[model samples]
Target: MAQSVHFSTPVDTVVSRMRALDTALPERDGLAVFNRVYLTVTEEFDRQLDAGLFPDRRAAISLDVRFAERYLTVAEDGRAPACWRPLLQFRRHPGVRPLQFALSGINAHIGHDLALALVDTCRTLGCEPADLEDEFDRVGDLLVSLEERVREELMPGPDLFQIADPLTHLLGSWSLERAREATWAAARALWALRGLPDLAEEFADRLDSAVGLAGRMLLTPLPI
Candidate 1:
């Protein structure tokens, strides 16, 4: 089962909950594939924290836990945002490859959930988005490196690398760089609109819808 455990707000507990999900899910399950990648990334983030990479350790911990909670919420209850719906909906489809699943989940988490997480962390820590920029950049750097590794490890080989290949275009169509840029912008906008709860929620809903469209494209069925 891909169902997750009871997760607490603490960082270690977050990691442990993800680990439990990883252990319970089947190896080839799409949810498991993404969960495994997320587990590795979260563990790496935890290590960097322990090593004191962030200048404001407290801020970093707050952001990390809040960011993780966005995904864990869905993992625990299937109460996913629009951006996450595509991956959850198509996860079991035979035509959706492992790499597709991985990327779709990444697209949803990075593009949509991240912005909300930033806002959430700021609210919890009584800080502004500007205050958390350094920690955000550090985590972004880690994500960039890990994304490259994920592509290398999960991407299909030369046999699937032709101009005519749908996967080629699909892979090229989305860029992590662009996504991060947009996420940061969204976070700032969200922060600015915090005073107007209605507008802020509308903005978030639109962002979620936009990211969901991208995720749906990423999960487009491929030939089995």
Candidate 2:
């Protein structure tokens, strides 16, 4: 019989692990911090999924919870509070569409992969093919919904240029510091997703490639 999955570790244990992970992240680079945060958050989400925390085998709720905890921790950490605030603000702001779109894409990718993994695991455990088909259909519906949400977020609006302009200006002011941070965050998110099974591994690989391109863009010299 397949063993029932459960979260054996206490909540405190997960929190401690997250704290340790945060402390180990690079402190001098804002881009590094962004990458680290996204990576860490995704890992926590996967941990929750592996532990069977969600009814639907999706990572959205877990991501929200992990993100909240991370934000609280950064706000309380005196030495890094200033640096974290802007990032947190960006997350909360609706005008920063690209960041939101990127996060939504990450979430959708992970959620879809997890659902597929769960279906495969269930089949291995002797689930009937019909039931497995049903589950797959459900997961497919969810993925469609997630994709639609991502599309809506990514769609350019009248303020699209306006929103991107400020970020571009900020990057120019800091010589791509913020852009570098965004790249780092993308890398970390991909790293965290790497822990999933084969499907997730593929998704992570794609994300890794995307991050690499983004990172190169960040490092490109801006015309003076």
Among the numbered candidates, top lDDT falls to 1
Model 1 lDDT-worst window of ten: 1-10
Query: Model 2, range 153-212, lDDT digits (tens) per residue?
Result: 544566656555544553333222233334334434444454565855675456445433
- Over 4 Å off, model 1: 1-9, 160-164
| Runs in model 2 lying further than 4 Å from the true structure | 1-15, 39-53, 57-166, 169-207, 218-224
Error of 1 at 174 (Å): 0.5
Q: Write the per-residue lDDT of candidate 1 for residues 159-199, one digit (tens) a residue.
A: 77652277767878988889999999999999999999999
lDDT at residue 51 of model 2 (Cα atoms): 62
CA lDDT, every prediction? 0.86, 0.41
Clashing pairs in 1: none
